[model samples]
Target chain A: MIRKALIPVFMLMVTFPIALLLLLSFGKSWVYPNIFPDQFTLQHWNDIYQINSELLMVTLKSIGISLGVSSVVTLLSFFSSKHISYSVYKSRWLFLAYIPYVFSPVILAATLQFYFTFVDVSGTFFGVILAQLFITYPFGVLIFSNFWNPRIKAIAELSNTLGGNSWITFYKVVLPLSKGVLLLCFFQVFLISWFEYGLTALIGVGKIKTLTLSVFQYIQEANIFLAALASCLLIIPPMILLYLNKRFIFTNQQTI
Target chain B: MTNQLLDIQNLSKAFEDEHILTQTSFFLQESKTLSILGKSGSGKTTLLKIIAGLEKQDNGTILLENNDITTLSAHKRNIVYLYQDALLFPHLNVFENIAFGLKLRKINAQEVKNRVTKMLYDLELQKHIHKMPTQLSGGQRQRVSFGRALIIQPKILLLDEPFGALDVDTRKQMQRLCKETLKQYKITTLFVTHDLKEALIMGDQIGKMQSGVLKTFKNKEEFLNDPSTGIKEEIEFWKNIHANEE
Candidate 1:
């Protein structure tokens, strides 16, 4: 009982920095001694909103890139995983899929940077998307492959016998059965794309200006306030996405 | 005969040098129930999979109505295999799950609605038509699973201990429901189980499997009244292994 009580306290303790950043985002100055900011001003937010349409464009670009990366990752994973699960050599393919995940992203990026430059595709949107897709595809494959095992195959076969074709079985039966896992995959890929800095920065070569890039630039300029605000903005979409995903997961769990 | 909807001839399967089934043969008559009874690892499921075209036989022939279906894929064979788990589509409501097969056939919306509605009503699942699979009880989920399979109206219905997960009471109820429903549709069923009582209750003819060979009986009385020492030994083997577990 005490452990349960202490959980929220622990959570708040860990989240205080983020919360403080969010709070400070609405304030003009952070020099106040009080626990809360004395003067709450939307001046920073308003300035970003009014002076820089670039910020909005960058935010949208980040979201667009994330969406593109997630969709490609999900599709690639779904097919590859489905193939792996149904194929004769499932174990071998699965082991191969695990290789990318074991390597650190830094090492991966450093190695791939040379290849991207050789292909004359380095520091472009396509290059970043491709890199992130490589990173996120394995997750999609792993999750969906696990989700696509014999149990799901049984359900699918049942559907097929009932007069469903392969496409029909996939969309109507297999996809729905693994919706939760797919959602989890989408959110995971989205988060990976959203927060991904080193790979994008390395491959993007300052050509791509995502929210993370904006935050990093502000931090480099010693503009902590702007950086905090940008970070707060960056955090909101994923937070909302995660919260929605939790609601879905919990609701499904309860139904089960 | 025209009535023999499925025929298996000397089918064999092996998994990584382990022979799961060998030289198995059977014929499933239309609208009749054939139950496969065996101890665990007796290769009952492997035989069913070979018949269903889900797993390939290293050497054998499967004929659907005298047409060799051995080379046919699972999807093309029109054989439905129900798992021990209900394996319902979690995202779809019960009605949608039941409608899954019809939709694949490109059936019209009106037809789908009418057929699914009839199934829901017939299965006494009207209240659960909108409920997700997770919202259903064990019995209810099994009924939905049955509905999903039956809705497709497959040529062959294969059950891999479909009621094994349910409580005793629910299992009994589901068994009764399954018998009643399949009888109405006149669907040919091939079910595998370790439970003698389930075999007796659900099977019109029982195929007693040892290792991979099947010794079939016309009825439960024939199986029980057999004076052959081999029959007695097989029954004892199954009883000692399966009956005591529950």
Candidate 2:
């Protein structure tokens, strides 16, 4: 019975904040002790794009950098896990999945800050993406470990027996078969980089500001309505994504 | 010797100190089926995998049509192993699964379509041309697997208990399909099974594996007459049980 109630509780936890944000975005100067706003207006929602044009640009940039990070990390971690899994010595190095994610992203960024400066990408978009990869890439690597199992290896060998070269088999069989996990990894990494604050601030030196930083900026300024709008913006994409593709993270059956 | 399609000499393999296959030698004639009977853990699957070049044997020479293919890679060996699991590529449609080998060989799309369509009709899976593996039944999955294996026209077909996981009716149906497919393709086949009935039903020549060693007989009579198989006693035991029940 309690378990049945938990979902309703969770739904309230999600919708109550969004409901308040919706009310705030439309409220005209809501203040404490005013159970309802003295006036209702679309002022904040209307001004969201017009007055806060920079928020729009920052959100776009956030998406761009997150996609870049997701793409590179997907490929990088794929090859990383593939190499470690397919090592000639047959020694499994699953530890690669742990190390990067184990470290705090801020500490990881600070540790690699000097190297980013030497590479002349610090305070740049590329540097910001690199900082986020420190967390996302390990997750991708761990997600792809399932693709390198003995059953899958046997499938690869079967491909070979059917006259496919390694490259051909990878393209036709391995990649197609792993499409589910790959999409999962890509979106998971995208969400991580999307909401990422610490690494972006540290490595980009606050120059490459994202929407997440803008929400923080509004909070610090005590602009509750704008902060609520920006927070909703940050939360909305992942919510829609999770709703549309729940199997991308949750399913256990190994079908494509 | 001229009739021989595959010949193995002094084959041996071990995992740690546990010997898996010991001096296993066999000869398969052109277009003949050789069935090996062994219990689980009797190294039946390992032996077939070694022959298909998926696994390396510690000592052996495999000659296919008088060519030494022992050092050849699995890709170059022209031998295909059908896993008992019927591992159809889950993402691919039935047509694509059947066309997988030809596509890998870089066959043209038109030819691939022609061949796959014909194979689909031949396997009586024309209605499921666009269906994924998950949508297929157990028997349909095996037919698709058989279609994939036979469409390639491989030099040797190694079947490792292809019917092991099916129910009684499905297993019988699969055996019929296997018999029809092999007869149509005329592929030299190495079929390993623990089922005595399946062994006799599938093989032109019969062999048995015991304690990592293999013995092959020239014909079914010879195999049935062999004392180690316990076929005589097995029949008598069933007969006596029936008598007692009566």
Candidate 3:
């Protein structure tokens, strides 16, 4: 049947780019009219192990920034979204959360550039993390806004009246109930921080060299091998996160 | 005054310019249930929330056991409030849901297990102990919610139309179970509902709320005799139906 025949085609289409990237990361070089590289080598992989490697440090820096941004944004957004959801002026607050998204990340970064430069956090490692939050935090708030409904509010109230302190009520009831949304929000925002380029470039002032910027720089310099390597490195964390999300959060009728 | 387990004096609440509850006051004796019957927008739920410390009153004094708990936080109030929806923790199984309050108090794990098991048996949910809340029926979920609240041995229990969403048969069954359990546990409860029969059946004392003002009756006879309670119209309607059948 057409459906059955199309399955492998669809799968190959989905996987071909990643497979090509992995293969190209080990290739020596590509020449004109060659579908594949002239030779394969692990020199680029070996380069990653060299002492004081920029690639290695940049990769770690990207992971650290994404992790930091995702965690703080997710936690802050979860609580802030709950407060906003319960507030009488809910729509007004939600409109404020939407302000950052009204512009492209680059333009938002440009507007915030003055504040960052004035505070002297621009071009610093912490600066990029803070800049990423400007985009991710509001997104996290928007994602979790739908999670806190009247029923959830009632449940929290019930927990309080059942003799649970605020901390107990959150970890015992709210966190457990919000696990799926939390994970989904964390993953999405992690990706946002991970693949972010324009905002990072503008705010980081090119001093904070993230893995995503390295990929863009390599591609611009026509360094196909290193570009593929950077792409492979970039895909690893999000793929693992996606696998974990599927295995745990979505397995047993859980929904965000 | 000493026998009065819970007392509210001059309670009032408002949202923006509209007053939801104004100058409402009542008292509940120890080990007795007070049923407040009111229609929607009658401020019955606001009164219950204020008593449970979930909402702060604009003006009031709430005395529990002659102790002024006016500004006490909700968790410290030792008051358990049940919502119309069961609102069970969906991630937890029936046993875990019942054990939630005990765990929150840092009780020993084995004792928590035993107490929750006993509560589950009492609620006739022993077979569904391992099932998640979403796997249970509405009546079963409500029973679990009750167990969760009652296992903590709260000082006062507030029910906000707890069985309002159940079917007629399930509602009757839940009412009977609730009455028996509250009696056995000697729980002083403030039960609010809109149903006339349910209000009369569930309470040792009866009150009617209208337009933010609550009037508590001394006895069933007084409540029935009062023309404002609509008891007379209810009785006449039933009597006329019976006569037509004859």
Q: Write out the backbone clash pairs for model 1.
A: A123-A204, A162-B152
TM-score of each: 0.80, 0.82, 0.95
Positional deviation of residue B84's Cα in model 3 after best superposition, in angstroms: 0.7
Top TM-score: which candidate number? 3
Error of 3 at B185 (Å): 1.1
- Supply the DockQ value of model 2: 0.58
Off by over 4 Å in 1: A1-54, A85-102, A246-256, B73-76, B92-132, B151-153, B169-177, B215-230, B233-246
User: What DockQ results do all the predictions give, each relative to the true complex?
Assistant: 0.47, 0.58, 0.70
> Candidate 3's residue-wise lDDT over B78-125, tens digit each?
999999999998878888889988988899999999999888888899
TM-score of chain B of each: 0.90, 0.97, 0.98
TM-score rank order: 3, 2, 1
After TM-score superposition, what is the CA distance of residue B141 in candidate 1 from its true location, in Å? 3.2
**Candidate 2 colliding pairs:** none
Model 2 lDDT tens row, B15-130: 98999999998889988899999999999989998998888999988999999999898888889999888888887889989998998788999999999998888888999999
lDDT of 1 by residue, A61-159 (tens): 899899999988887888778888899998898887788768877778888999999998897888889988777887788888888787777767666
Supply the TM-score of chain A against the true chain A for every candidate structure. 0.90, 0.88, 0.96
